[model samples]
Target: MDKLRKALSGRDNSDEQEEERGNIMTQTEDTPLLRVMDNSTLSWNTRVKGFAICFGVGFLFSFLGSVFLFLPNGITIFAVFYTIGNILGLGSTCFLMGPVSQCKRMFATTRIIATIIMFAALAMTLVSAFVLHNKALALIMVVIQFLAMTWYSLSYIPYARDAAKKCFGSCLDL
Candidate 1:
């Protein structure tokens, strides 16, 4: 946790370590860390980037999934969409970590919205699967995806708010 704090602040405790070694600490006001901490707008910019990336991924998933649906071989198309969707969704979350770590409120809000959308999407997919009465492979994939999304949202929501509070005092603050 201390390491995380240091990385997020872009600061090192070398000055303090030097002081303990009977060495005098030099003040470096022109350091990048100083500039970063002094500028509140950078944080806001990061949040904007984060939100855009998340929304873009969701859009891509929907578009690609729709396209795949029109292809031949129902089971194969569903499998492709299921695999790609999960991979892309997880990858996008990894990208969001930078902004999420910096802007807690924005992260929490976006994550919650994403969770809700994921739930709805899964529900709709299940209904479609049942109606289509296609191959068992597609149905099995949907069930797996449903379980994964359900577990992810359930576990994520329970701690997301607390993590946001610990990372930042208020939403949209630098």
Candidate 2:
């Protein structure tokens, strides 16, 4: 019984130690924003949990939005829910990569155009839904949003954009 108890306590201690190791932060250059991000960084487990919850909510919102498309005022409802889901999904990445790093990557030269288009599409989606109330325009903007987001995501993978361009060019030529 005593041996079993020691083993259980040892396991608990190792878990705590592992958590502490994950929580340790390394010093970086002393800039105000970096300092804030460094200070605000969460433990690995907490970060993963936050990311999962946020991403799940984002997916649910998008699914609900799609479901509402057949009802009255469905376009506006769909636009709003879909836009919110995209925002949440984008924001969820910040949990895995610090906000500063995420922003830097977002605005990087290769992806800047895609990022701008994505953001513009998101804004236009809302504007079309609320202000213009044009279902066709809203749908168009949603398509743009999805494409821009895809392009932006592809920018993160090396040569992905080039490969896509080549594939599309060949298809167009054919």
Candidate 3:
């Protein structure tokens, strides 16, 4: 049990000097957020689980959208999915707080821009599909969302992988 606790805490007996630096620096290494973002052994597992969760949620939303896409009020279903996804996304942002705080000056504006574009696409989809009830416009919004997602994946994923590499050394698999 003690071994398990120590391993989970991410401490090495050889790193006693780190503890003297300060509580925040010492505690940060063991934080779950940091582990998710940077730990070589654990980050990949956490990322896989997060990907699964996002995929499952997205599948559910897609299924619902397909089921109601033809109905007169079908767009509302997609709107609900958008709302739920947004809420989930907001909750997930908490995981980034530690990393963001630790390296505020390092964050790239491109990442922020890509994220904003993605959110704008979501908003466009919700407004066009649900509020305006314009199927064609909604389709356009979806295309925009796809493009935004591609942009974000290209820009942010590489940045995150690189950051993880820097944090955990080249051995970090991201």
Q: Give the TM-score of each candidate.
A: 0.39, 0.76, 0.50
Residue pairs of candidate 1 with colliding backbone atoms: none
RMSD of 1: 13.1
Best by lDDT: 2
Backbone clash total, candidate 1:
0
Per-residue error at 115 for model 3, in Å? 1.4
The local lDDT score (0 to 100) that residue 81 gets in candidate 1 is 64
Ranking by lDDT: 2, 3, 1
Question: Candidate 3: what lDDT?
Answer: 0.57
Q: Is candidate 1 or candidate 3 better by lDDT?
A: 3
lDDT by residue (1-174, candidate 3, tens digit) is: 556434433446754465566556446557766555443334434644654576567666666666676777676676657445543543343333323432331245756775677678788788886678787787777767766665655553547646644767856655
List model 2 lDDT by residue over 1-174, tens digit each: 545433312325764576567643434455766554651446666766878999999999989999998898799999999999999999887776667667877898998999999999999999999999999999999999989988998886779989999999999998
Q: State each model's CA lDDT, in order.
A: 0.52, 0.81, 0.57
The regions of model 2 sitting more than 4 angstroms off are 1-36
For model 1, residues 1-174, the per-residue Cα lDDT tens digits are: 657434544336773476466432135545655543342224534744755676577557646765776667555556456645655555444333442333443236545554555555555555555566555645565565655554454444657656755666765465
Q: How many residue pairs collide in each prediction? A: 0, 0, 0
Q: Which runs of model 3 end up more than 4 angstroms from their true locations?
A: 1-20, 23-51, 82-107, 156-174
